[model samples]
Target: MTQAQNPFNVVFVLFDNVTQLNFTGPAQFLCRMPGAKVHVAAASLDPVMTDVGFGIMPTVTFEDCPQSDLLCVPGGLGVAPALSDIQLIDFVGQQASDAQWITSVCTGAFILGQAGLLQGRRATTHWGFTSLLPMVGAVHEDARTVFDGNIVTAGGVTSGIDFALTIVAHLHGEDVARSLQLNFEYDPAPPFAGGTPATSPQHIVQAMQSRFYDDRAAEMEKALRG
Candidate 1:
């Protein structure tokens, strides 16, 4: 298809146990871009649940997904299972081979790594899992949004909003992004000053680590090796 005639396709990889906001946040902005057509694709047509109480149904199946201009993966507790799905990994690898951009929010970067897409790429993930990047050949960078060529990885859940705005600014221009931000009223005046490990109390960080990510590194290593 001619460049002008071709639609800008943005495909989101949807699976069970995802953090819904990680997918929904970016998608809200991405779909607003000019000529952008958004899709949620999964291994099958079944409904998928989020780590939270809700569920979503995939609009497309991997077997029939169109080649996407941008491919996005979302992360949550579900990523561990996604990492073990060889079909999903191969599909991600195939899509990444030709996609203009491969992006992820939160632990979604791990999915990209499992797809063999992060080799030597500078990437980032949720703060707690950033260390796991090196195991999959990615150079870990601590930032809200990281761009290493065609790969853009966002840190944590809320960062997905920032990641989307960044992508839109780069692809569609700052004016478009700014206008969209205004439309969304994207100003943030967070109530607490302890969003990051550096800002949060050591005890709080430790408690979080102990609760959510104590064994994640080892688990990821095993998943990657398998």
Candidate 2:
């Protein structure tokens, strides 16, 4: 795509249980990426409620989502149904068939994997699910973010901002990304003791898995069966 002629069309696919921060983070960060244009695309026309209770009105449907230059799947509990929905999976699977750069935040990687796009690709997801990546045929990489081929996957939720910065660096230039990072004062401040499994105590991790991630885990397993 030519620079002047091509509008860098970006679509972030959202669904129920999607992490609001994943979309909001990158949307805010990359809103400044030169010619980058963004839209919220979803499986349905209805306003999809996120896991955190935020409602995102999708601007386009999968069938209607414009030919995207950059396509992102932002992770959440939505990844559960998205992986299982053949239509949604087929829609995203087509993205890999085409040449558009595909990216996912957190467990969105699981959706992409269900579409059979991540087979043998080096990808990363919410570090909590790192061990789970191999089951879907991804080469698990332990990183805050990982870039392999056309796929760029970010760790957990907040990392989506950094992932967008990286894309800005790749799409525009490193200077632009760095500038935005500085503009945002992109530094870490964690209110909690654990951001990742390694940082969280074993008991805490187990508690999280049992209490928080249990339903989502079951949903994923059901999707994998299909």
Candidate 3:
């Protein structure tokens, strides 16, 4: 027989253009928690097109999202588009006001930053957004995961799995987290050995980065203005 260390209700907020891998990785870990429940929330109840063009049917809308013990925000290309929605930004900000833990993956930290939730909180996000995050009052931790008291932020998309395991440990104790980890048998072998800008070949990294933001650069300028 085992004991439940803590009981939790989790709310996962998804938006259009969100990266599916970013959401799915953490979700897989969260759903495995014993006696835990999750609510999938969106700006609207309608299906959202992910950054990769996959669609997800949201189970709840911001208007109807259940109050949660934990609020999770996921990041992707959608962030640039979603931040334009003041209500959604406000929703995440307010939700974190009462949540026991404010968690984010990848560029999801951008949402928390816009909501002003990450101010003074040590956090991390996708490598590309690291510099901008600190400008918003974050500590700019460069790690696969950063746990600053109640705020937990993970770097990049694949980092979601590591962050979730950390969360499970915090809530249910290391024993439970270890058990879950053993159950999942995670043995990842990423083909790309590079993670951060400093470690990767500068030429390849710069080229890849240029391709990503080539279009967004103008949009980013506009976003800053309006």
Candidate 4:
């Protein structure tokens, strides 16, 4: 179907304990894409629990989801267990077969990787797990968003917004994307200059890695191996 005539079916694969912002941030922007139809598909129609101590209701079951124009996976603490869910991995692989864009935010890249979609692709994810990309046959690209052909991977949670805006610009035009940015008042002025490892104080980065990411990365590595 022609772009003007086609409806953009954007599907987000949801799972229990997902980081809500990883999905919600992008969904908020992508939902505004002209003719966009957003579907939150999960293993069942039940509400999927998120890391924020709440749940997001799925709009459709995996069995009922439509062929997607864009397929996205969002990640959180649940990713380790999700890596072993055959049904979820299968759904991602199946949807990607026909999707115009296959994407992920944060450690959702691992889900894509588990589906064998990231093989030989340049990808990125949450900084903590970047080193593990090679385990899934993906080459790590140190960027907020990495596009390797039709596969787009975004780093961490908030980066999903940038990913969404980039996709909008690709499918629509700069004018439309720019308008969306303006509409959302997308200016970012963080209270601190420590968003990334390079920008953060050395002590802060070392502490975070030692206290959190070090173990988190090890857990992810174990999951990927399994």
**TM-score, every prediction:** 0.95, 0.90, 0.90, 0.97
Candidate 2 clashing pairs? Answer: none
User: Candidates' lDDT values, in order?
Assistant: 0.92, 0.83, 0.84, 0.96
What tens-digit string does per-residue lDDT give for candidate 4 at 1-226?
Answer: 6566767999999999999999999999999999999999999999999998999999999999999999999999999999999999999999999999999999999999999999999999999899999999999999999999999999999999999999999999999999999999999999999899989999999999999999989998899888
The predicted structure with the larger TM-score, 2 or 4, is 4
* Tens digit of per-residue lDDT, candidate 2, span 37-115: 7878777789989887868899889888877788888888777667767877787877656646899899999988888
**Candidate 4 deviant stretches above 4 angstroms:** 1-4
Q: Which stretches of candidate 1 lie over 4 Å from their true place?
A: 1-4
Encode model 1's per-residue lDDT on 84-103: one tens digit a residue. Answer: 89888888999999999999
lDDT score of residue 62 within candidate 3: 89
- Cα lDDT tens digits, model 3, 46-103, are 8989988879998888888878788989998888777778888888987888999899
Best by lDDT: 4
List per-candidate RMSD values in Å. Answer: 1.9, 2.5, 2.8, 1.9
